[model samples]
Target chain A: SQTIHQWPATLVQPVGSPLSLECTVEGTSNPNLYWYRQAAGRGLQLLFYSVGIGQISSEVPQNLSASRPQDRQFILSSKKLLLSDSGFYLCAWNGGTANTEAFFGQGTRLTVV
Target chain B: AQSVSQHNHHVILSEAASLELGCNYSYGGTVNLFWYVQYPGQHLQLLLKYFSGDPLVKGIKGFEAEFIKSKFSFNLRKPSVQWSDTAEYFCAVSSSGNTPLVFGKGTRLSVIA
Candidate 1:
């Protein structure tokens, strides 16, 4: 079975600090990876998705960026965090095929103070 | 651009009450639909999905959803809900198999025992 792992299950950082969140998938190769943010009481917002290594499509313009360094390793980063950047960040993976269901990681609760 | 709309932001119901959560999407082309559940302090999990073939899709924990293409709607239903069913439900849509999903504002279900 495939599984996704996300690091720093909870994070607390001061404003303007650099941020990095990592996600990795096991038991699958060349999977589609995605980064999503869920604000309190709000639905999820897709931030970035990657089809392959070094290929990323951003869904919205924001302070965050994503990268796929390996076939199953994805990273979400920010040079400087903002107060608005604090939220529940989730990493998901799906089979390379289209319309496939996605599997999610435990998600990181980021708190930017 | 694809967008999803979930009618209720929050719902409170007693155990065994019927559930019907409305979801609508805006897209003219063929689309895929999905329902995800997020338990408290846990990651999001796929409840069900509709790609092709059957319009009514059943999922775990006695949850099901029907995709009505004519109305551009995929509504989740349950004949009887348990207190354990209390969670946040999200509706998502994608234009193609490989496209990034657009999620709704989400409906928070509170099933009181």
Candidate 2:
């Protein structure tokens, strides 16, 4: 069974501080990974997605960036966080095939004070 | 730009009441549709999806949705919702295979006991 893990279930950081969130998938190889953020009372917003290691596509323009260091590891980082960055961050993956169902992680809630 | 729209922003319903949430997408191409739910203090979970073949698709927790191509809509329905159904619902769409998903603003459903 494939499972996704995200670290730091919740975080409280001051504005302008650096931010880092990690996600890794188990029991799968060469899967497409994604990063999403959900604002309060809003839906999921796609931030970045990677087809493989070192290859990333950003959906929305922001201070966030993503990296795939290993086959099943993904990292979301920001040099300086803003209040608008406070939200629920989710990690997801798909089989990279047509119309394949995407699975989601438990998500990390970040609050920028 | 591709986008998803959920008609309802917030809804309050009693237990055993019928549930219907409207979703529409703006993309003139083959698309994959999805419905996701987020409980209080929980991550987003897949409730149902529609790729092709059948217009009416069933999902977990006794939820279903019908895709109307002519209307560019995929509305979610549940005959009788329980109090546990109180959560936020999101509608999403993907235009191409292996592409990123675009989500709506989401509908907040509060089912009373």
Candidate 3:
């Protein structure tokens, strides 16, 4: 079975600090990877999605950016964090084909002080 | 922009009671629908999905949902729910196969034993 792993599970960073969150999927190749953010008691908001290595689509413009360095490895990064960046970040993946059900990893709770 | 709307923000029910959560989407093109469940402190899991064919779809854990094209609604239902059913449920829709999913604000269900 395919599974996604994300870390660190929780993070606290001061404003203006660099941020890096990684997500990796095992048992699947060439999967579609996505990054979503959910503010406290809010819905999931799409941030970025990658169809293949070095290909990324940004849904919203903000302080964060996403990159697909490998077929199964996706990373979300920021040169500087903002207080508004505090939220729950979730990593998800699906089969290469479209309309397939997506699988999610344990989300990372990020709090920017 | 296309969006998904979940009517209830929070729902409380006793064990063995019927469950029905409303989900509506605003899009006219070909779309795929899905319902996801997340237990406390766990990752999101796919409860059910609707792509093509049957309008009524059954998912794991005795959960089901029906797609009504005219109403643009996909409502989740369970004949009898248990205390173990306490979780946050999300409804998501993707208009085009290649696009990212648009999620509803989500419904928090608390089933008391």
Show where candidate 2 strays beyond 4 Å: none
lDDT of 2 by residue, A1-113 (tens): 99999988899999999999999999999898999988866778889998888989998899899999998999999999999888989999887763767889988889999
On TM-score, who's better, 1 or 2? 1
Best model number under TM-score: 1
iRMS value of model 2? 1.6
Q: How would you class the docking of model 1?
A: medium
Model 1 Cα shift for residue A73 (angstroms): 1.0
Error of 3 at B84 (Å): 1.1
What's every prediction's RMSD, in angstroms?
Answer: 1.1, 1.5, 1.3
Ranking by TM-score: 1, 3, 2
Residue range B1-113, candidate 3, lDDT tens digits = 67999999999999999999999999999899999998988778899999999999999999999999999999999999999999999999986656777789899999998
lDDT for each residue of candidate 3 in A1-113, tens digit (9 for 90 to 100): 89899999999999999999999999999998999997646789999998899999998999999999999999999999999999999999988765888889889999999
Badly placed stretches (over 4 Å) of model 1 are none
- For residue B33, model 2's alpha carbon misses the true position, in angstroms, by 1.1
Residues B51-105, candidate 1: write the lDDT tens digits.
Answer: 8998999999999999998999999999999999999999998877678877998
Candidates arranged by DockQ, highest first: 1, 3, 2
Candidate 2 vs candidate 3: which has greater lDDT? Answer: 3
